[model samples]
Target: SNRFSYSMNLKGASMTIDTACSSSLVCTHVSKLHLRYKDNEIMPASVVNGLNLMLFPGPFVGCCAAGMLSHEGRCFTFNSTADGYARGELCGALLFKAKQFNPADGGLCCLAGSQTNQDGRSASLTAPNGPAQEKCIAAVLKEVGLTPTEVDCIECHGTGTSLGDP
Candidate 1:
């Protein structure tokens, strides 16, 4: 993060978040909040990055032991026969800016809002609570003064497991 900031000449606050599967989304959520919380003079923009790399076999072995790796070696999310999710690596970043700073080209797209929630009573660590997830989405839409129909897209965090996929 520091290296990227140095290269880009960004001096605002920067940090890393490691919440496993939801790390990227969590980073995005935080960035959205930061863009909204601070004034233009302080921080009118923010950058969020997430990387999942398996440089070693420790995590692979651990997930295998915990039966978190799919036997078919593929992710069958939302499927009834899903055993687990397929593990992989990804590196991505997103730039978030305040509405007032929108470029003349209109930029890529606008991030209306973001929200995070946890399922304390989930069946397992990787399991997703449908109700909790629904509540979180509802809250975000309501906070943004929009209904379900107005939503253009929803990037979700899926685990491939039967309970986790939903």
Candidate 2:
């Protein structure tokens, strides 16, 4: 079973942040909020993703499992003989300015808004809870005054495991 993976460096706009699965996405949200604040003026339309890998399994196991390896010399995206996603490691850098640079200095990436929720239930210890998931997402939509229909994308943590889907 594959267990580890790696990626190279990436670019950023104003500041580089690191979170777990929500890191890259959170950074993007914050950037938008900064733009709304009108502290800076630079905000790129598109952003780039950084290298991120996930490894380690013990307390629990989901539907997804894999690994990473360095064979001869080249780097691999997803090898053929690989099993599942070893460990999930992801890094993302975005282009954005701050809401306030130096008090007198203006032109920062004003944050428009952001939303966050949680999966309250943790089945055994590392399992995902559905009710909690629904509540969190619902809260975000309510805060934004939008409906689920307005959501265009969903970056999920399915893990390709039976538990994740079934």
Candidate number with greatest lDDT: 1
TM-scores for all candidates: the values are 0.87, 0.45
Q: lDDT of all predictions, in order shown?
A: 0.81, 0.48
Top model number, TM-score? 1
List runs of model 1 lying over 4 Å from the truth: 100-103, 121-124
Candidate 2 segments whose C-alpha is farther than 4 A from its true place: 1-18, 41-49, 53-114, 150-153
lDDT of each residue in 34-116, candidate 2, tens digit only: 55554343442434345655455541243222222223223332344322233444554554444343435443343334565
> What is the C-alpha local distance difference test score of candidate 2?
0.48
Instruction: Count the clashes in each prediction.
Output: 0, 47
Q: How does candidate 1 fare on TM-score?
A: 0.87
- For each of the candidates, the C-alpha root-mean-square deviation to the true structure, in angstroms, is 2.1, 10.9
